[model samples]
Structure formats: C-alpha cells, structure tokens
Target: MNTNKKAMMSAPNTDQNILKEENNNRIIHKKTDTLVYALGGLGEIGKNMYCFEHENEILIVDAGVHFPEENLLGVDYVIPDFGYLVKNNHKRKILVITHGHEDHIGGIPFLLKSVDIEAIYAPRFAVALINKKLEERRMLRGVKIIEINEGSRIKMEHFTVGFFNTVHSIPDSLGLLITTPNGRVVETGDFKFDLTPVGTNADYQIMAYIGQIGVTLLMSDSTNSGVEDFSISEKKVANAILEITKKATGRLIVATFASNVHRVQQILESAVASGRKVIVFGRSMENVVQIGRKLGNIKIGEEHFITADQLSHTPANKVCIVCTGSQGEPLAALSRIASGTHRFIKLIPGDTVVFSSSPIPGNGQSVNQVVNKLFKAGANVLTKSILNNLHTTGHASQEEQKLMLQLIKPKYFMPVHGEYKMLVQHRDTAIETGVAPENIFTCANGDVLLMRDEKVYQSSMRIPADDIYVDGNDISGVSTAVLKDRKILSDNGLVSVIISIDSRESKILCKPVIVSRGFVFIKDSQSLLKEAELIVYNALKERMKTRTTFSEIKNTIRSTLEPFLYNKTHRNPIVIPVILNSKAAMLQMQQQRALKNSNHKAASE
Candidate 1:
C-alpha cells in the first residue's frame, strides 16, 4: 500500500471533527491540536514569519525578510526558507501581515509567488505598501489583498482571528488574538507602550479585557528585552527634532528609515514649524512619502515639498532635506551627499546632518564612515551619540515587556523577535512576572510547540527554518559558487588569460593575453604579466600534440600561474584561463585533419 494513501485514510476531517451549536445555529468550530512554528524571526531581529496550525488548516502571520549578517558577502537580504510554507501551502488559507515594515512584508512578494494563498489580510497602510511592492513586480492582479482594521475579526474554518491596534514606529500596526477550541493565543506584533504616540496607541482596555478572559498563550516581541528601562517615547523624539531643526543656521538634513512614517511626519512638522522648505531625496524615501501621503498615513502640504530647481532658488537657511542613510548604507541618499557624489544636494560649511535613527548591529562601522565623511565635508554631524534623546527605539524594554506580561498574564508565554540571549532574558522576565518556568518556553526558529486542551509543550516535529538570500533582483540563481566567486573577487581580485589555441593539435596559435583587474597594475607590473604569459605558454607546450582536454590545459595553467603570482605579489588572485579556439585556428586544424584522412583513403585505394 502507498504511504500517502495510508496517511490520507488516517487523516481526520477537521471541518467536521469539532462543532458547537448556540441558539440552534451551528458555529464553525474544530477540535484543534495546535502546532505553532516559526520559519524565521526567532533568535534574530528580522525576517519574522510564524505559522499556526490546527489539524489540516494553517494560518500564517508576518512574512518578512532578514538583513544580511556580517559573513553573507554580497547578499542584499535574507528571507525565510519557505519550505514549510510550500509543503503546507494546501493547508494555508490566509496570510496576515502585522505592519508595512520591510521585515514584516518584504517576503510577501516571494511568498505570493511561492505558495497558493487564499488572501492576505493587513491594515490599510500595510496594504498600500504591499500594493506598491506587487506593482513593482507586476503581480498585483494575481494577488488578493484584504484591507483590515482594528475590531475586525476573521473567522476561519478552525480558528477565529481578531486584530487590535498596537503602537509602534509605524502607524496601522495590530496585535492578533486567535481563538481556538483549546485556548486563546495573543500575538503582540513588534510594539512599545507609548501613552501618547504619534498615531494610535495600544488599546489598553481591550488588552485588559483579554487578560480578564484568561489568555491560554501569549507571544510578545523581545527585540528590546536586554534593555533595563522603558523605551523613550516617539513624542519625545519629535519634540527634540523639532527643536534641533528650529536652531539650524544653514541647511538641515535629517536622515532616517523611509518606513518610519511617524518619524518622517515629525521631520516634516519640524520643517514646517521652522519655516523651511522640505526637499526629500533618495528613491526609497521618495516612494515612502508618495505612498504614505496617498494612504493618509502621512499628511504634508504640497507647498512644503520642493524640487532640485526650487532648492537652488530658496535661501540656504530655509532649506530642510529629509533623506536616507541613517544606518550609513553606501548607496543611500545621505551617504552619497556625505561622499560628495550627490547631483543636487551638496554638503557645505554650517550644514547640519542629523541622524534620526539608531545604527543596527553590525552597521556601526558603516555609520561611522558616513559620519566621518560628513565632518570632512565641513558639515556638522548630529546623532544619538553626543546628543541627548534624539532617537528612540520602537521595541519595548524590560519594564514595558514586564508590563505587557503582567497585563496579559497568559498561562504559557513564548518570546518572539530577538536573538537567543534576548529571548532568554524575556523568559526570565516572564518568570519574574509569575509565569511558570515550564510554561515559558524558549525555542529557536523551526522549533514546534504543540498545544492541546489548554496544554502547550515542545514537540519533536519541526518546520524548515533555513533562510535564503536575495542578491540583487534574482533569488534562486545565487548559489554557493556564485557567492564564493564573489568573495574571492572582493578579497583577492581577478586575473584573466586569453589564448588562441589549435584545437586539433592542442597547440597555442598566438601569444597569451593577460588582463588583470583590481589585482595588479599592468604598466607597473609589465614584467610580472610577461612572466605569467611565458608560464602559460610553456604549460600549453607541454600538452601540445596530445589529446589534451580544455579542463586539463586550464588546470595546468592554474597550477603553474597561481604560485608565481602569489610569490611575486604575496596575494592570490582568481586566475581565469580562457582557451578561445579562434576561427582561423580551428579552420586550419580541420583542413589538416581532412587532408590526412584523404591521404589515408588514397593509400587504401
């Protein structure tokens, strides 16, 4: 018997497995032995994707991407492996997005292409952003995107999901409350407790009500678990920035993440209040502003925005530019200006460049390099460092995390969205807040937690949580060899040798041409290149008249040239030997072979 057939026969029909009747009407309920797993966003800060399953149905939350780590040489971003989602795509119905940040929605484009999704549910702002992404990929028509808001509830066949507002760096963020037959699980998307945020704050009353009803399980953000105090308010950051721009004598340039719409709003507010014209740069920042304004997430007057032509006409004192590169990304707008490469914006004396964001881990050196450039260009650089309260984090600190844990007071707690150490610290904080040691489970990506009849425990079955890289535009073509070659080029540079060879006789028909890029100077290293050409010529002579394959000839050249180049330069360059069978050379060899065959035929006759 086939294993699939046997498994199908044993599989339970969850649609009719569990149900209840209230007031003579049947409610869609199912007996859910739940399996909760994280394909990404565990044991790290970004790439947050989670799966909730009951029997044959699964609901996905927060498809995101991770920023490249230190060792991932040329990778732009890392997305979830998606193997689990692909395997269980039939079981998946809806994918719920928490917000519009790239980490939360970056992988949506890939997920839409990889799996069979029924629809995607997100807030209006997130919908607008995801629509922009899909439009870029020309995938808008094939996707079903549903715009949801607070107080909205989606009842699936097996579970019911409710969304409530949560304050974060961006607007339209929501926390999910999922109800199943066994228990209720609340997932608070990345958040902080800001009594007075720029937009909407967390619904304390609703959270308290959920706590009163007794939540069975709770998953909370652990990004700021290691911090001891509460995060500074976004309102405070706005106030400080407003004052900073008000005192600018010349041009004021504020750098921040484009996705932080609230921060951009504040920057605009400051620019307006300071009576300065706002000129936005960077393609990413321009797109965010365009979408935010259209979606009503950001409101700014048209007169406040000026173009490059208008910028030159305005007084320097009345100019304010909001750009990218707060994290010191090389190609971002602010970095270009700092390096004197920007076309429109040029840094001059008395210009104040404010970094309105914090540097992500592993990006401090890059940020420092940008700052050094800004100083060298005679601009005054301002950052959270050496400044009092310029930027604030969006994640909850230890005190705020405790408050959330105390307010929810769930029977079981699992920390999401942080490194391993941060997750452990969150678990300890939960224990201090009266959660049971066994109930507070700390798991990494792909670790499965099973819940049945109000009991949750670690299960042996796990999902695939390996991550894939998105290098440039193509995702699948970036294999290990591609990355290895990239690292070799970046580290040691490359050298190429082009040789015209006689294919029939396996002999060199001309002098070898040696070209080097980022390896050695041709004019200064002429002697070295001459030596390399001679070495390659000798190797080809060794294989002359033999049935030498291209691989053997190339390897022989590599074996002879690698040591010579290394001994001369004390550096290893990637040697590439190109054996071009020239048209003339191959034609001559063919003619010789034909003549030999004709002479043999004549002798036989």
Candidate 2:
C-alpha cells in the first residue's frame, strides 16, 4: 500500500512524439474499467483539473489555477504541479475545458507553456473568454478551441463525451456526460437548480434524457453542500440589484466576478432600466464584456455602456459603475478605488458601493479590508450578509446536490469541486439518496477512483503532486523558505553586517560595520548597532585562525543575532552577513603587528 508511489516513472517524451504513439494506435480495446484522477480541486477550493484515463489514453478536463492563501506571499497564482502529466503526456488524447471561470480555465496558458495540447474543446461563450486570455498570453498560435453546443458529442480514443445544458450564474454553462468502458460518468460543472435563472433555466429535458440513459458514476459539485437548503435564484438577485440601483441617488458602484456574464448582463439591464449610464472598469471585466458582446453572449445597446474615460464628464447621479474584484483582489478595479488609488474614480459622500458577490472562503480578510477602506473613503457600502438580497451563490446547495443524485441515479458517486468537509457532506447526501456507502468516495487531490465491470474501487496509489506557484512569468514550487524569509523581513525588519576581508591572510580587515534597515533606526539606536558589531567582531576573532567558509560566517552571524535581536527588541529581524570576498580575507593586521614587534626587537638589540 505504497500510496506515495509516483506515476509515469519513465522519462518524458518530446512534444513532437508525445501524441504520435497514442494517435497511431487508435484501435480501441475497450477495457472494463475507467480511471479518474483528481489532479486538483479536492480539498482546496480553487485549482480544478481532472483526468479520465482508459485503455492507456488520457482525457483531461478543466485545467485550472488556484488562488494563493494569505501565507503564500508574492504569489500571483497557484496551479497543479503537472509532474505526472509531463512524464506521461503520451497518453493525453485531448484536453476539454468545462467553462470559463478562473478555477476552470486559468491554468490553460501555463499548461500551454510546457505541454503541447493540440485542441481544446469548450462552449461558445467559454471559447470567447478563452480566446481573449490566450491572445493576452500570446498562446493562440498552434492551438485550436473547438466550439461545442449542448448536443455536441466529442468522440475521443477512450471516451465519448456528450454535453448538456446546466443552469449557472454564467450563461452557456454545460454538464458533461462521458461514456467510458466502465459506464457513463456525469460531471456537473458548477450548477444550481435555478428554475427562474437570470439567463435561462436548467435544461431539465436534456438531463432527464441522460438519466434515462443510465449513469455509472456521478461527479458533482459540493461547494454549498454544507448549506442544507436551496440557494436563491439569480433572477431574484437581479431584481434585488435593480431595486438598489433605482433607490440610489448618487453613483452606484457594483463589484463582481468578471466571468459572471449573466450577472454582468443583469447589472447592465439594471443600469439601463434605472436610467444610469454604465461605466465598466478592470481589464478582465472589460475584456470579458467586449468578447461576450462580440460573440453575442452579452447583448446591450451601444448607448447604455461607456468607458472609464467618460466617467469624469458624465453626471455622477446618472452613472453606474460595474467593476471586478468583489473578492478584494489586490490589483482589481474595486480595490484600487476602495484604496483611493484609482486615477479617475473616487467615492463621493452619497456614493453607494454594492458588493454583488460574496467573499470566497479564503478571501474574508481582504474583502473586509476593502470594505473598511470604502467606509473610510466616505462611501456607503452594502454587502450580501447585511442586505441578504445583494448576492446569491452560483453553486448547488445540499438540496440541489441531493436532487442531482436522485435524478442521475448513479451507482457510484464521488464528490468534486469543494473542500474536504463539503465533499464528505456530499458523500453523505449520496448515501441518503440510496447510493451504497462503500460506493461513495470523498477523496483529496491525486486520489484515484477506478471503475471496473460497472463496479468502483478507490486506489491507494497516488502520484507525486506539488503546488505550482506562478509569480509573474516564472513558475516554480511554492517557495516556502523564500516566503518565510520574506515574512521575517516584513515583520521584524533586517540587519546586515558588512565585513571586508583581505585576500592575503584569513582575518577581518577592520571593525565589522553593521547596517540596519527596517529594524531600529541607525541614528536612534547606535548602542544596539555597536553591540551587534562587537558580537560579530568577537565571533570573527574566534574563527581568525581557521579558513572560515562564507556560509559558515553567514550562519554564525544569523544564528548569533536572531535570538539576541528578539530578546532585545521583541522582534526577530532577518540577519545577513555580507562576506565581501568568496574566501576569507588574509589577516593584514597580523603581518603589521608582526613587523612592529620585529622592529622593536631589532632596536632593543
């Protein structure tokens, strides 16, 4: 039961030859089993990627990125490690995307950076957003995104995937019905039972047809599984937002997810109905809106929408601003405005700031910080928690999950797209729907589920997986030591000891000079600096005879200063010893002292 055994132990293949071997042997010997690998999005809330492998052919679904936690300092985003896929990419036949949400499609650019994906299959609306993102990353070359509809059937080497309509906050969402050798797997891509949805109601007719076809496994969303009731409809939220916009006398500002096309549509309609000219901010929001309009996914009159440049000239009472960063993302439009850093937009006394989206689980602190900043900026802020009708969840609740379970009638169920607790809750719900307890799997990232002969079994084998952190254009593992050092420097400040060593002998040239930054100011704390210098000088004196290594000197300096600095100032500043030369400087003072003694002795004789 060595679950930690890595997958694809063989060497990696070149991009030119990876798919050659798989594509050449298209003759399918349908095995009686299907392997499901959860690359990400098991215990975590974001980064949603999965793999379905059968007959040595892999079909990847939803390559996505995860948002960094508070502790992941300087990280722009996090993604799946892709180690297994990199080693075994020859098995990949095609990559399919579920939707356009960041959690579902944000990692495409990064994946394309390394892996050579031939084609990407997505719906029309998702394709529009994906094209814009790909163009931004300059990754549109050599890539093809096939636009799919509800009835489109994609026949791969190991699976035949069929699409069905689902109700979501974003328009043109789809549910996947993948036919494999083991049976059929129904993948729910973020849905809610919204009969009166803002865009269109869930396609119950298509879903019932799939149910009649009989499903083998149900991989469902568990985001709101902890809530035991149904979530409010998006249409209700639109009406509520409309009412708020009508009552506001000054500029009404709304912040939400940029990919929420239906929400954006509702806001636009509300703006038009309330006789307010809409101004869209944030690059992502602008890009999505532009692409959506071009693709005919978002419809609005030309006069109803204006750019940010026109905000200054437009009357404040007649303006409605829709922007990104309801989650308090650092560089998003709402954050810039809340911090009073936006070049054009500023909150007036009568301005109303409405957050139409609730804060994500890990984003409470940042959202609160933004709200507090908005309050300090003299704007009236309204949140869903306080107003109750401002925001509605796009995920299926416990009741909806239960309903899906009953409708699909899956013999085996595995909860997807949520935390561990949510997954467990969903598993229990599946049990309540009469699915056998042993047939339900509440798995974590990298846990594999194998369905064989219409029976499902959870495997102990886990492939090596690591969090791939993206900081700008560079992709690396979550640099723990670097983040820890950064935290220390930020919290306690920094202290550096500059030691000039001679190239001749192994000794210090002069008194070790100490420079402090962010710690106690040099001008104010000379005594502390002097004492620190003495400590280093004494340590150097002890190592004067031996050829001390640079790392040795740095370690000695840091280990010596850390506890003392903490004890003295109640702060543990980052300590660095700058060894000027790679080798210890030759001791010039010893030669000078020896010459002085020889001169004295000669004079005395």
Candidate 3:
C-alpha cells in the first residue's frame, strides 16, 4: 500500500493554474490520511520548521535556528535537531526557505550536515546569502539551487507551491503558499505591511487571487500579533537617524544587528545625508555590508565607506560609524569601545553613541550594562530611552495582522512564531475578527496537526529541537540543563565547594573549600565565607555515613549547605560540591586536594 501510494504521489501534476482544485481531489481522495508536523518555530520564535504530508511525499519549510540567550556564555549559535527529518527523509522532498534572517536560515548550515535535503527553494537574496554560508562549510557543491521570485510557482506531484513578496529587514523576503490535495495553506514568514518599504511588502494581488482560489489554513507570524498599531517603516527611521547625526559633536557611532540590512541602510543614508564620513566597524558588520552592497540592496560611496583608521584621521565630528553588538555581545565593537578595550577608538565625553537596535528579550541587563559603561566613560549615550523613535520593528503589528487575516480569510488559522501567551492572544484576536475558535490552532514544538478533507486533527510527535552552541569552530548541542544553569547563575550567584573526602567513606577530609559568584563578595563578608565553609563541611560529614553515590553526597551537601549558608550570608549561591577520592598513601595529595577545594571555595565566595 505504501509503495503504491508513493508511485501515485510521484506522478507529476500538469495543471498549474487549476492546481488547488486538482490538489483537493488528489489529497482528500486518498485512501489514507495526511499529517502536518512542526520541526521548528513552535514554542519560541526562530528555527522555523514545518512539514506537510500528502499520500507519500512530504514538503518541509524553513529549517532555521534561534540565537542563544544572554546566559549561554561562550555559545556561538544554536540550531534545531533534525532527528524527525532524518527518520523520514525518504518522504521529504524540498526545504522551502522563506527569508535570510538568522532565525530562518541560521540552522541550515547545521541541518544540512545531518539530513540530505533533495532541493532548496528560496528568494534570490536569501539564495546568495545561504549559498555563501553553505560554501563556507564546503556543503554547496552538489546542492540544487532554485531561485524563486514573487508569484513563481513550483510543482511537486500533489502539491503546488507559490511565493509572495514579504517585507522584512532583509531583501527578497517571501511568504510561502503550499497548495495541497486537500487545500491551500499560506505561511506568512516574518513580515510587516510597510507601504513604504525599501522593497515590496507582501504581494496583495497574488494573495487576493489565492483568496479567490480558496485557502483552508493560514499559518501566520505571531511574533508581534499582540503588539498594537502598524510597524513603523524603515524609511521613517532613516529620517530620524539623519536628524540625530546632523547635530553630533564627536563621532556618531551606531550599533545594530549585522543582518538588519534595512537598519544598516538607514544608518548609512543618514550619515551620507548628514555629510558624515561612514566607517563600518566590526568584521561581521563589514562582511554583511560588503555582501549587501554587492547585491545592490545597499549603496555607499567608495569615499564614504572607510576604515576605522581612516575615520581617526578624518574629523571625529564628521564621521558616523555603523557597527555591531546591539545586544551588547561581549566582543562586539560597541561593547569594547564602551569598556575602553578597543585599540583604535575609545568613546570620549563629547562622543555620541546611538543604540539603533532595541534590546532583545533576556538581553535587557546586558544592554543596560553597555549603556552604563558608556555613561560612566562620559560618552553622550542615545539608547532606546532617549532615541525611542530612532528605531522601528520589522515584525508586523496587530493592525497589519488584522489586515492580512481580513485578506486571506482562511478556514483554519495557526499562529506561529511566539510564546503560548502570544499565541493565545493572537488566537483571540482572530476570534474577535470572526475566525471561529475551532478554526484557530495554537500548537507547541513537536506538535503534529493532521488536516483531512479541510478538517484538522492533531497528535504529539517529539521532534528533536535543541540549541547548538558554537565557540570558535567547535560546535556542540547545549542541553536544557545548561540553559537552566545559566538562568540560575545569572539570577543567583554561584557557590562552589571543593572538599577532600575519604576514598572508601564519604567523610569530610578537611575544611570544605567554598567559592561564590553572583553572591556576597569575600572582601565584604570574610566571616560569611568562613561560615559557608563550615556549613558545607558539616553537611559533607552528615552525608558521609548515609550516602554512597556521588550525586547523593552532592545533593545532601547542597540541600544542607544552601539554607545554612543563605541564613548566615543572607545570599543564595549555586552550591557545587566536589568530592576528591584518593588512597591512604596519598595523604599529602589528599591534603593538597582539600587545600585546593578550600581555596577555590574561598575565591568563588
């Protein structure tokens, strides 16, 4: 039956215009049902993965990765696990990428290493961007590249796919229209209805035609669904930035996302218009600008785009430096400049620093730290607080979402790209707009929604979705436990206890070493550290007679030491208990271990 179904699905469809009508008959007319699965972009935004199955062929959309939160220290990037795709790769046909945003394309390099995709369809700019990335990995050799323009149609047996222009920070962003045997689903990739966008805001006429053709489901971006009003256009921000650069006393340094070409263009144009020499800072920022300029998405005079050294020679007041590290990433140019760590440039009192990008969620503290450093260095800082109107979001707001919903008028609505609250709010918004509650589907990561004959049924399928942490060239998956640990360390301080325990019996061999971070300092509370060590030592002794496993000894030390130390020090630190197992002949070695633990704990505290 499976073989027969595969043969039938492998048969190509000749009718492209009447594809939807033919799809309805072929999809619903099947003996078996079809399932829709989410490989990414379910609970949290980014790493968007979705699959639609018809008979035997499956089409996957948007394999991407999310950026690591603030506490993921030393992590380079994150990607989704492709276990589901690998297990079912025989049925998977093509990966339809929506845009070139990090969240949408960041995982491609990592994903391709695992699952061999048949083909990839993306817009021109995204294709160029992705090809550069794949080439860097040496994975672009045999890959089939299909450049899809707005209104272009792709046929794969029972499914007919179409692309519509989407307005985002990147050029050539597109929305996907997957017309299956049963119905049509319009996946609105990250976009905003910017009437004055640098490029096109989603092709409405094509959507109107799709609406006439009839859409059963509309899986839309819900990142800003709960946000009120329309997204402010990039053109508006350019004028705002231009206004700020005109009155700058010292060098005007603007920090933003490297991938935000729209924002970069605005900053560059603002500088050029203000008669300021523009110097691009940061290696990553320079790379992006070079690519965008080559593709004609951005333009700057050869005289205008200069190096930091060139800017130093030019009058500081006549230079506008566009750089990276808007999130206050430690090694970013802005962060280094603020810290007085950069060799070429240091922010002076009269200098103007503009944070053109807003702080992403979880990066508030880091952003504030950078702002504080700039302020402390006597630089005149202009952040979101003062330069509130200096930047605008690329995501579509409530009004735009409502307009989109009103346009497509799908039978079923699935809200993608947000947390549970955002999804529920979006669902309710659709409900208020007359979309039936039954028609709105709010799903999480690893959920499978089956649509049969225009009716949707859902089941749970655990798709391996996780973060890939990279430092330098080394890449590894970060466990959930590591993220949790980071959250705890950032929120509360870390308290480490190094102890020398008996080889056979888990007894306190010496004064327990205690170290604490994000907690009370040893200089201020010397007595507190002494007390914490005693607490840890007593707990280790208490567990020595009862515990056998390493984990038990560690847990007992934590539970017993945490409360006692917290009560005494008035601060809670992450308690790490280390047990040193050794031989009786190694008394000096044991003492050294005990002494090392003691010193480590003292330093940590």
Best by lDDT: 1
List the global CA lDDT of all models.
0.87, 0.83, 0.78
**Number of the candidate with higher lDDT, 1 or 3:** 1
Candidate 2 lDDT, 518-582, residue by residue in tens = 88878989998888888878877777678767677788788877787778899988888887753
TM-score ranking from best candidate downward: 2, 1, 3
Question: How many angstroms is residue 14 displaced in model 1 relative to the true structure, after the best TM-score fit?
Answer: 27
TM of each candidate vs. truth: 0.87, 0.88, 0.77
Residue 225 error for model 3, in Å? 1.6
lDDT by residue (tens digit), candidate 3, 1-605 = 66555655665753322122233333222344456767678778777888887776778888777776656865667666677677776775788888888788877777776677888899887888888888888889988888888868889987898888878888888888887877788998888898888766668887787778888889988888778988777887877788899989788999998888888988888889888888888987887888888888888868787775676688888888888889988889999988999878877778899888888888889889999999998888887654367778888888888888888888889998887777887898888778999778898877766666766655433456554565544445666677677677777779888877774555666888777777777788788788767766676666677746778878878888889876776666678877776677268667888999999999999
How many residue pairs clash (N, CA or C atoms closer than 3 angstroms) in each of the candidate models, in the order given?
0, 5, 11
List per-candidate RMSD values in Å.
7.7, 9.5, 9.8
Question: Candidate 1, clashing residue pairs?
Answer: none
